[model samples]
Target: MDRTGKSDSGSSSMTTMGMVFVKAQNTPLYSKAWTPSTTGGYASTCIFLLILAITSRMLLAYRTRLERSWHDKAINRRYIMISGQTEADRERQAVGKGGEKTEVAVLTANGTDERVKVVRSAGRNLEGKPWRFSTDLPRAALFTVDSGVKYLLMLAVMTMNVGYFFSVLAGLFVGELAIGRYTGAGEGHH
Candidate 1:
């Protein structure tokens, strides 16, 4: 080991096997093409990593929003079915009298009939095909992008550059602090 605790294999390469964090400018981040040759280039790489981390959090927020929307739609559909009301009926009810928003109570009383209806509805919706092209395609695309960003960040961290690692961490912190509240409590962690 050398003075910096890095193994001295007489190779003089910028890459090291040491566990210690280094600020080497020649370190490749994410890809060989991203190797920084100057202080400015290194700083830019750190900033890019930070931005990428923040973007990952943003994608998570968007995915959460999309999921909530789907849940709301499902609930609305169930409500319509259980109440035996058409969309036009609901709209007319909403526009009744003084323009005040009326809350419609959902019937959840225990009964075999209601349970059977719910089960039938669920079965029809599923149709033994859980993956619908309309819904699952967008979801799969979002997951793919999210996974790609996460893996990219992981690769950047594997570079073992102190500044790059901290930049990504700071981005995550800032992103969570800024956009996390809108995603609801404990939603982004998953």
Candidate 2:
């Protein structure tokens, strides 16, 4: 009666919205008649995508935290003060160089002055004089490669930017979005 010129209730039908049954083969279009289950398909997809977005964001945050903790343990430290002597003086009291490399005569991390050999060269050479730096292990170590630790904290911000941008994009295109910032990214706080 509506479109095929027959009784409206006279066809093999499928239940749609409002419990109305319509002939699946003869339904003109679905936009006006899609069911709850059909709409829920898209909703469920969105929920799953949201869950995925959140999980990935948390995982990335955990990864960065672990990495930072490891880095902190590496550079947070103590220091040592060593005496200096001539390059050619082997038996002389070379606080840090070529003299009596005393272990207890300097301020240090373990509180014992241990002479550690540090080699710095112009570059790796085939046959150059090996310049060695002998000093008491200093307890003072810079938190970051830079003298200031704020530089190291930039890692946290950069990580946030990458994760945030991707999450926003996912929300817009994939129906998902989740992002989080870390403590290290705090204002003048790291």
Candidate 3:
């Protein structure tokens, strides 16, 4: 009841002070536009959240994979540069019957020298600019999408609807179980 002496019961459930942890249906999730008007609608929303969480995990896994691949390529490029291998020599070696091995001298801790065998393989030339628009642009786009999804999931959890919260938890649990072994520890959250 308000100062006007009129009933406010109709909108009472929709309004709350802050962060009500209640198992409620027909509640607004993220925005008023997503307010579920029926039990089935709420259930559907929960399912959608669950799927979103799983997709987020998948995206994280892909990002990790990309990072590793790029790291390896960078290392390869550095080795090629350090070895002073010319493009013509690299091309000839790559086209030859068997690739040649280069011996690199290593200094040991005890002032001893050791020789390491490095196998050179032909790959994309890394002599160009450090950042290429073709690769960096797509990586940036992927990062933007990944961040957007992560924040959207966070906002959904902030809704404080018990069902929705549990749904997200379940999805994360299931997604981890499915792809956890493939991804590194603590990678999913980021």
Candidate 4:
């Protein structure tokens, strides 16, 4: 081992070997984290975390684009009838029960029948309660996956491995660049 306690192989082999999963039991930031068990486990762990961080960031970026496109498509779509009842059918149904024409003042809950406008606003807001788990299992499952992966990637950077930390940082930077390239490249200006 050299003065820094790293092997002469210039791969920090000393620090690589026998690296524990938790350096400080209380503080995760001070923890020297490694997951591999092979002779070159430390290097492998670093590389694996690096790729995961990069891929996670990239997936997040693409998800944003997908959400945008989905919003656009949803807003543009024109569903004349929501519950299989056409507009004319609704109007006819809205007529007086006794076949007498009565002025039926139709007002939306938000006092606006402009569905597209409402949909656009809804997309911008995260104001709705989550759907029931029984009826929307996939939503909950995906939510857990997304949140868990994101947090784990963040915690991996706190391992304090120089290689691992830099890999995550570089991944975020490159992922942002990739996302910007796909999104409006010149939207920064008025």
**Model 2 over residues 62-155: C-alpha lDDT tens digits?**
5456545644443332224334544354234334332223333434567643443222222223233323232111212322222232332232
lDDT of 3 by residue, 1-190 (tens): 7755455874443333675787779779877998999989999999999999898888878887886676556546423223355656655544533333343435457662323224443344334427957568877987899899888888888878899889888888888889877677777564
TM-score of 2: 0.29
In candidate 2, which residue ranges exceed 4 Å CA deviation? Answer: 1-37, 77-179, 183-190
Tens digits of lDDT, candidate 4, 74-165: 44433232234456755664452334232323246766352221112223333343444542474456456667766776777656556566
Ten contiguous residues minimizing lDDT sum, candidate 3: 112-121
lDDT of 1 by residue, 22-95 (tens): 87878998668879999999889889999999998999999988877765454344322345666676667555
Give the local distance difference test score of model 1. 0.72
lDDT of each: 0.72, 0.36, 0.71, 0.51
Per-candidate alpha-carbon RMSD to the true structure: 10.9, 18.2, 11.6, 13.9
Model 1 residue 49 CA deviation (Å) reads 0.6
Segments of candidate 1 deviating more than 4 angstroms = 1-16, 78-130, 188-190
10 residues in a row with least lDDT, candidate 4? 114-123
TM-score versus the correct structure, for each prediction: 0.64, 0.29, 0.64, 0.45
